[model samples]
Target: MRRLVIVNQKGGVGKTTTTANLAAALVRRGWRVLLIDMDPQAHLSIHFGFDPESNEPTIYDVLTQGTSVTEILRDTEEGLRLLPACVDLAAAEVELAGVDDRHYLLRNALSPVENEFDAILVDCAPSLGLLTLNALCAGFEVIIPLQPHFLALQGLMKLGQTVALVRARLNPMLRIAGVVVVMQDSGTLLSAEVISGLEQILAAHRRSGDAWGDARIFSTRIRRNIKLAECPSHQTSIFTYAPKSNGALDYAALADELFGTAAAAPVAPADAAPPVAAATTRDPRDAEDAAPSESSMRTATA
Candidate 1:
């Protein structure tokens, strides 16, 4: 199975959105996907209509109470499974601070069922705390969801450093697969500049024998779409909520790119239930920016 962590220390960078939708996209390609929500906010869980307050055993229990992950896995209408999270997870960092092998908690928990899915996507918290560290230890590939802003650009360097530290101290096989720019506005010059900066940064890392040495800035950039921001409120993925929207199209292309395949032959059932009404709105943000023409799109062959 391909174990990947969708992470960004910078908030509102679309990590949760990416995790939720990418898993759905992969499932449409007929790949079994397992989503692990590591964020204390439980947005990923809530996005799938699993209310965290239902007094169910969650990832927090798996990590702190010696509960099995399989016991808490829940199936979603999107054809993907999830190890949900709850608000009580916010205390896990402090609770496990003094625990031995705290960093490997998630890695160990996932080992038993590693073969059950084609991909396991971990939705990490925005902060670089113990929760994020556990995700770093558990996942082999890191897909960073970035928004086009100067501060978000700076946060990439810090996140890269965190990945480097984790690689050295915990999981040596950990690598950044690629970056997906989210909430992008292709018409903005600043967006293009941010993508240019990212290419330069990634190129530099590739030259330095870093974790992202083989990484590329993915060509399939997620476009700014209100449909994407609104899907979670409807408790479904973009593909399910607005299959004809730009958000669904972009994510489908992204899934195809990730798997080295053409557009996915739709595998969803014809009688699948229609999505619920979209009501709430997230704070709008820019999606992925442009990829420089000269930027390396191929992963450097090891």
Candidate 2:
């Protein structure tokens, strides 16, 4: 299976949104997918109408209690399955801190059933904590979902260093696949400029042969669409809640771009989203993404 961890230390950058829709999109392409909600916030679980409060067997059980994938997997109407998350997962990092091999818990948990699916997508919490480390150890590649904003830009270098540390100390196969720019505003010049800056950063990393060296900005940028945000509350993916909306078209196109072929061709972009706002030429704040201490990173990689 193609095991991928969708991660970003910054919140509200479309990690859950991308994980939900991308899994849905991949399922539409006839791939059997397993969605793992590693975030204790349970947003991805709630996005699919699964009640995390119902005391279900969650990933928290998997990591902390040794619950098998079958015991916690929730079947969805779209044919995709999920190892759902609960608010109890928030305690996982602290609970597992003293445990031996905590970083490999998730990797070992998936070993039994990983072959049963074509793809496995894990939605990580917005922190560089133990839980996120578990994901890094389990995943073969990292898919970073970024927002087209300067503040979001101010964290990629830090995340890249985290990936480098994890790759050296835990999972050598771990590398970045690419970046997906979400909530893009074609109407805003700042958004365009942010993307340009992102491209330059990725280009520089490629030259450095760092952990994210191959990470490129995906061609299918997620346009700002109100429907994308609204669908989560409705407890379904954009494909199901607003199939003909701009949100649906963009995600569909992105699915096709990421996966070789999709079962459903993207329909024409719809007008269901809010009208693009007029471009306001504002300069993005020039902030820096703090990398890990050179000594620590070098020690890890050495």
Candidate 3:
């Protein structure tokens, strides 16, 4: 299965929204999709009608307690299956702190069911902690959702650095699939400027050629749509909430663009042996101070 991690250290850039809609769109296109919510907030689960307060098993249990992923998996509309998250996941960092090979905990948990899904989308938390590390180690393709803002560019840089580190240490096959601009308003001058800057950066990297192998910026920009924000409140995807809405159309285009090129490749087998020593480093947050408030979830929905 092709594992795609929808990640952005900046929360408001629409990572969760992209994960939800993209999975829905892929399901519509006849792919078996698995959506994994790695955020402690459980926003993805709640968006799909899961209540963390209930007694049902969550991704927290699957990763920390070795619960079977198939047992906790639940089907959604349009044939997407979700591995829900709960608030307890917030404590996983401390709980797994002293454990060995903590970084590969998630990868080990998901290894058994890797072949069950055609596509696995991981919705990561806003911070660069154990949870996000798990996602980086588990997935081969990284899909960064960016907003058209100067600060978002900085966040993207940090995320790119993290991905590079992960590749150097953990997963050698990991690569950035592409960068996606979300909540774009083409009519605004600021948005236009950010777009220009992004293109310049991408073009420079292309000229260098060695920095990025095959990664390219996606052409389908996701426009700000009220329908997209509204759908999560009703626990539905944009397609089910309003199929004709711009939100649905944009996500469908993105899905088409993503799968049209990579659909035929077979999923990689899970890592059977235990992870090596490098994956067990302490939390990156403890070494440095917490990310600035502006870089955290402050702009989560913007």
The 0-to-1 C-alpha lDDT of every candidate, in the order given, reads 0.82, 0.79, 0.77
Query: Where does candidate 3 stray beyond 4 Å?
Result: 207-212, 261-302
The candidate that achieves the highest TM-score relative to the unseen native structure: 1
lDDT tens digits by residue: candidate 1, 109-218: 98898887878999998899999999999999999988775555776788899999999999998999999988776566767998999999988888677887888898
Per-residue error (Å), model 1, residue 59: 0.2
Weakest 10 consecutive residues of candidate 3 by summed lDDT: 272-281
Ten consecutive residues with minimal summed lDDT in candidate 2?
293-302
After superposition, which runs of candidate 1 have C-alpha atoms over 4 Å from their true positions? 262-302
Please give, for residues 113-200, the per-residue lDDT of candidate 3 as tens digits.
8887888999999888899999989998999888876666776666777887888888877888888888875466666787787777
Please say which candidate is ahead in TM-score: 1 or 2: 1
Model 2 clashing residue pairs (backbone): none
Candidate 2 lDDT tens digits, 1-302: 57889989988788999999888877765677899999999999899879999987899999999988788888887677988999989999899999999999999999998888888899999898999999999998899987766566777789999999999899999999999987776556666887888888888878677797788888887766677889888888888887766667777777667765543333312332221211122223312112223232111010
Q: After superposition, how far is residue 246 of candidate 2 from its true place, in Å?
A: 1.3
The Cα error of candidate 2 at residue 236, in Å, is 1.5
Which model is ahead, 2 or 3, in terms of TM-score?
Answer: 2
Better model by TM-score: candidate 1 vs candidate 3: 1
